[model samples]
Target: MLLLKWSAMGDVVIATALFEDIAQAFPGREIHLNTLPVWEGLFVEDSRFSSVFAVDLRARQGQMQRIVEWLQRVRAGHYDLVIDLQCNDRSRLLLSLLWLVGCHIPYRLGNRRQFPYNIAPAELPKPVHTMTRCRAALEAGGISATTPRPVLSLPQFNHARVDRLMKAHELREGHYAVFMPGCNAKGYLKRWGAARYAALANRFHEDGLVRIVLIGGADEVDECQAIAETCGEWLVNLCGQTEIFDIPLLCQPARLIVANDTGGAHLASVSTTPMLVICGPTDPRRVKPLGDNVVTLQADLPCINCYRKTCSHHSCMSMLTPDRVWQRVQKLVQEAA
Candidate 1:
């Protein structure tokens, strides 16, 4: 069996629930996951997956050549079943190419009713959440995905790395807050302003919730840096220092995690730690982090959930005040306690 979940960190994290579902459905069967190279380390040590295959098909240079080579490898494996959890054009093309190469896998499953997929859900309603769509895809293949939630078990090396970070900062488990205040360049509208985050950090600081940690990828370094500067010594800016695999492990010990509608929030959702995700341009119904421990805050503006990459007014996020978010954060933290 081969499960495909490619690029975009948030979508991959949400699809992890199907990993266990497939593993349970077919006991003793070889289960392999194909994802981007950066995400390969996440499932390397996972017991449910027999192996993790990574290929960067996004690189325009030699992309076709890479696809041909990857297809050859797939054909050689002769996998009995191939599940397209990605359900995108790339995976669809891969499936189509598999047929073109005379590599006929018995079961080709996908979400939408289209070519190359012999099986799919009868009705995958419009504007559905990513997790729900992934679950419905798996269930359509006669697999039960009842327990739909993100789950991650990090390797010892990853845990040790986090231990060193916690010790170096003189931090204890469940005694600190993590703030993810940035998104990628294309999704800048999703950010809830660093100024508002600084104010929220000040609120947390005033309440004696010291040891606020700010984390993000290279794209988010400047945003996190600004927050750290405004909050002073209390904020530990670890932007660009942590790996994708380090997110869940780091969140496991945190008191709470506050993030924009970004991948970090989705990655942190697997942890039991309480989290709050601020949603603006994106629709929470379709993209919010999934878990009982996770909460999403969206402004009550008429233009909320516009799903627009660019906006003239930007009232959805600008109108969502820090004080309003802080109240919900306090309620969540207290409830978790």
Candidate 2:
């Protein structure tokens, strides 16, 4: 079987429940996943997947040749089945090309559409969480996706890596809180502003409680740095220092994880750690991180969940003040105690 999830989508990346459902249904069958080259390391080490094909969609050297070669490889495999978790235009194009080349995959599933997958398209209702949608797709194939949450397999190497990162940052297990304030370029509007983050850090600092660790990608370094500057001794900016794989492992000991509607929160959700996801323009029902411990706080506003990448007025996020979020945090802390 071939499973194609060939993008750097964070939400899709953390959809572990769907993977579990497929694994359960297939049982002992070999599961081959196609993903981007950068994400190959994530699944290649796992025992659940038999093979990982790192497809490079952004081939600069031999673009057309690469596609032909990849398609030829697909033809050679003569896959009896295809599970398209990607469910995007690109995947559709590739699948159509393969069909044109006479690669007949009798069984195809995932996504709600019928073109690529004409047989038993998933009939899930709207206003559902990401896991629910993924589960419905698998359930159509007689797969039980009762497992609501996702999990990651941390290798022995990550233990040492975690130790190195933790030690370097003078962090103790379960003694700190992770603050993911910054988001990707695509989600610039999702940010709740640096001033707000600084103010929140100050509030926590005033109480003299858990240490604050601000983390993000290199793109977020400057933004996180601005917040850390105002935070002084209260916050430690480790935005550019950490890797994607490091987040789930590091979140194991977190007292709390407060994140924007980014992948970081989703990564942290798998753990028992308490997380508060700040939903601005994104719909909580559609993409809220999956876990009992994970809670989402969307502002009660008229224009909430606008689903726009850019907003003229980011009142959805800014309207919900840090004080309101702080109250939720205090309640979570009390409950944890």
Clashing pairs in 1: none
Q: Which stretches of candidate 2 lie over 4 Å from their true place?
A: 58-63, 118-122, 333-337
Model 1 Cα lDDT, one tens digit per residue, 1-337: 8899986878888888778788889999998888998788778778988788888888889988989878987887889999999888988998999998899999999988888999898776678887888788888888999664687767788788998998898777867899999999788999998999999989988888768888899899889888888887877889999977788888888999999999989888888899999999888989888788998988888888777889898888888798998899989999988
Worst 10 residues of 1 by lDDT: 146-155
- Name the lDDT of candidate 1: 0.86
Q: Write the per-residue lDDT of candidate 2 for residues 198-237, one digit (tens) a residue.
A: 8888887677655899889876887798998887774778
> In model 1, how many backbone clashes occur?
0
Q: Candidate 1: where are CA atoms >4 Å away?
A: none
Candidate 2 RMSD to the correct structure: 2.4
Kindly give the stretch of ten consecutive residues in candidate 2 with the minimal lDDT sum: 7-16
